[model samples]
Target: MRRFYSYLIYKLYTWALNGSGYNTPIFNVIVTLACVHSFQLIFLMFIAFKCLPANTHLSGWLNYVAILAILFLISHYYVFYNKERWEGYVKEFENETPKQSLKGKIYVLSYLIGSTIGVIWLMYFMSVYLFK
Candidate 1:
């Protein structure tokens, strides 16, 4: 089960990084969101497995908060180290031609929001099902 879970996470990360049909900026945003969400989920699972009391709801909640803190620290480090790359991506998108159609705009927005929300939902379900 552990190996399968690890493999699944690895595949998801790779897919997030290499997803098609988006510009660099959009891709970066997608990747960042994926990384953040996955990191939080995995960290929470680890904490729950290692530190939390088994069969306790409060412990699970505490594990969640600890995982969030850890993820925030990791995200801060990533943002600090990749500041230039992020800035460049934003600049590139800012200078690019705007999408001309409402459909295009809707598609882009939906893609971003949908993926983020989907990942969050998946993580929530996984945490609840696997840990509880």
Candidate 2:
């Protein structure tokens, strides 16, 4: 998990550094928002499975999602906005072998793709079951 977090930080920084005029803060926000979509899926599943144990309606879910979004945004920005913090992560993992780097890329890519699909599926399920 530590390695994954570092790699994610590194990748986010590398992207911000490479393109769109070196806007680290903005890119960090964008990347974090993208990842946070998966959090919605987790939240939805928790409610669906009774893990959250909430007795509320769609508006309640939306409120919880809004809070979760704010929390994730602040936390992600806090950890990643510090240059030294992410720079150290980059330095530590920069020496990765080509094979290891490729594996990391594949892992991150697959996770994002799978989570996106999961979110879509869950959203559809909610629309059919909850909205109707």
Best by lDDT: 2
Candidates' C-alpha lDDT: 0.51, 0.66
Itemize residue pairs with steric clashes in candidate 1.
Answer: none
Per-residue lDDT of 70 in model 1: 72
lDDT of 2 at 45: 65
Give the TM-scores of the predictions, in the order they appear: 0.33, 0.64
Candidate 1: residue 74 Cα off by (Å): 3.4
Judge candidate 2 against the unseen true structure and give its global Cα lDDT, from 0 to 1.
0.66
Model 1 stretches with alpha carbons more than 4 Å out: 1-73, 79-81, 100-108, 119-132
Counting clashing residue pairs in each candidate, in order, gives: 0, 0
Candidate 1, residue 71: lDDT: 71
Q: List the residue pairs that clash in candidate 2.
A: none
For model 2, what is the error of residue 115's alpha carbon versus the real structure, in angstroms, after optimal superposition? 2.3
lDDT of 2 by residue, 1-132 (tens): 777767866765665677766565446645664576546656576556453334544645778778876786667555556656766877888888989888887887676666777677767776678755
